[model samples]
Target: MTLNRRQFIGTTATMAAVLSAPMVRAQGKPRVVVVGGGAGGATAARYIAKGSKGAIDVTLIEPTRKYYTCFFSNLYLGGFKEIEDIGHTYGGLAAGGVNVVHDWAVGVDRDAKTVALAGGGSLPYDKLILSPGIDFVEGAVEGWGLSAQNAMPHAYKAGSQSELLKAQLVAMPAGGTFAMVAPPNPYRCPPGPYERVSMVAHFLKQNNPTAKIIVADPKPKFSKMALFQEGWANHYEGMIDWIGDDFGGGTVSVDPNEMTISIDGEVTKVDVCNVIPAMKAGRIAEIAGVTDGNWAPVNAADMSTKADADVYVLGDASSQGDMPKSGFSANSQAKVCANAVRGALTGSKVFPAKFSNTCWSLIAPDDGVKVGATYEATPEKIAKVDGFISQTGESSDLRKATYEESEGWYTGITTDMLG
Candidate 1:
């Protein structure tokens, strides 16, 4: 078989199974094994290691050497950000005295509190953090699965998939129709699909002005719906169309072979389809028996799983309430989890858990809007205490400021997660 440079890079992106500079821990340090290394797991590992200052033995097991942030990937699609800007490596985390293991966590023995790696090894952990991120539920959309991903890229998880989707968009024919099969609620980035639509429109406006966008959304109202809708109409006008649940967004199917999507019993052929299907906890969380079918129900105080307090789940894989599944939320949750884990292991002072998340979406160049909230952990869930969202017709200066703020946030978050 022949492979191009991109394919070669993707395949070789993950390091060899054998960890080269094995960590030698001092006697009886509390062991923390982190599975998955995106915003959630990476932040947890880094914080646990840095806060402890050699007091905790932290091992981060992530298959990929570099993780691309799902945040601002839409900006990459919109040409505001570069691919390299979104991708980060574990080198910084390792330099901070973390044991970064490039290997897939295949299994978990909850009773033994051990993680099984695909590289023929097991890691014993006093505390385990599983931030495996999102995985599409099989058959979530009729006639769609991982097998059809090539034809209809989800690109929800970043890295190679994001690159592939961008390539597909760039190759789209002029005046072609771009279709999106938006996921149901409780998925990562509540505003992500709409933000994607705006970015795609931004690209098409500059490259192929006549191109159209179609969104099939299962939800009636989404985060910052009025803001996004107002922006779409003001900017894209007739170039964009959305079908909500009232119009059969809930009963939609796609056939990648035919390049057709069915909505409300009407089938339309589309040139490019981005199918963001129903999502669930990462496979490893389910394998660990920590998930309640779809997501790991974590205690709001520390993001610890109900099935096992020793195992914590974060990011899109977790079902903690009030906080939307977003990079900001994951990073916030990771801090709380880190403090709790540190106190449990090293007798360090633990603070009360407080969380916050802000989701920013760009409609056009320098035109941005945001929704954010602060939360306090209740006995049942993370309840929202206060919130704010951009108005439908905010000033251009404010929008530009919001966009600028998001840029700074992207930089801060990547550093927090990777380092």
Candidate 2:
């Protein structure tokens, strides 16, 4: 029978609750509860339900109706992609016979193996996966908070914030200055801020050529530094000035009301400011009592929490070694977790754990650079067994091919995660 929008939502939520109850397992099916349907959670839920072939019931809890990928978001700023290009839906996952619940997982009762929802429901599960990604540290940048987002958009989450930043750039006054407060190391997407700088510069060169870009980076060095620096010089020469820690980037603060940012005790008035604060594991992982400090420590082999084997963590929230926090890394970790979870629940033969990740950064039109590695599970962590990165001054043809490869990968990965 066809149902209206309200009825459909109500009926699906009821089905989610029933399939998530602990007693459902006594009906001869193990329940898997996955929180935060992004690269990690979506991939894990899809793999578990599909691999089990109905032997296990999978439920995914994500607050957003549509998931916008953080990867390639810089491309959005560069006008390389439209907003819809980066957005995905759970309709594919739901069609695969998984319960897709759009609700916040506000709490986790580890002792009871249940997840407390923001909408007044509890989901019981034999196995739990948390991939809630990152949350900003409260005091990382003084005078900057959620309330001031409109004045200085971070655009790190890649949706409304992205649109706001793009509009600000377009509306920027001639010869106006744009400043970026880059996060410290070990944050999500190491090369991301630099790529954003490149994209913003690409936009300004044509629209507002006299507009200047300033970067306040706390790190003395960054991922793909040589490549990005070279590309910046070639494409947007003299348009970008990157201030590193050695040059007082470490001592910086923002006055959002005044539209000014202080660097090394010198405050500069900026037409726009993008402040990317320090990040930590999402709250639900901490609520689950799985976090060790800023991130949840997990076994590299299976993405299972070190504190509790039955509960797993993936993506930016996980402190698994040798992998930067990117969509590629999360998707890789989720596959391993899916295999292990399926084995535990269905007595399936588990394969040896292997993972790989490649982060591609678009410096300019058809000029892309990348860093990637093959990883293997070890006693200590997910150690990098081999790696590769683009070199400075690469030929234009190769860089163009690399950029093409990134486009293809984006299409392939989004399909993989959403499906």
Cα lDDT of all candidates, in order? 0.90, 0.92
Candidate 2 lDDT, tens digit per residue, 1-419? 88999999999986776655433555658889999998999999999988988879899999999888999989999899998988888999999978999999999998898999999989999999999999988889888998888999999887889999999988899999999999997999999999999999999998899999999999999999999999999999999999999999978899999999999999999999999999999999999999999999999889999999899999999998999999999999999999999878766768988999999999999998999999999977988989999998789999999999999999899888888
Residue lDDT tens for model 1, 1-419: 99999888777653321122133234577799999898889899999999989978999999998888898888888888899988888999999988999999999998887898899979999889999999999999998999999999999988788888899999999999999999998899999999999999999999999999999989988888899889998889999889999989888899999999999889999999999999999999999998887999999999999999889999889999889999899999999999999878766678999999999889898898999999999999999999999997789999999999988888788888886
**Lowest summed lDDT window (length 10), candidate 1:** 15-24
Misplaced by over 4 Å in model 1 are 1-27
Off by over 4 Å in 2: 1-25
TM-score of 1: 0.93
Cα deviation at 296, candidate 1, in Å, is: 0.6
Each model's TM-score? 0.93, 0.94
Query: What's the C-alpha lDDT at position 235 in model 2?
Result: 97
Best by lDDT: 2
Q: After superposition, how far is residue 45 of candidate 2 from its true place, in Å?
A: 0.8
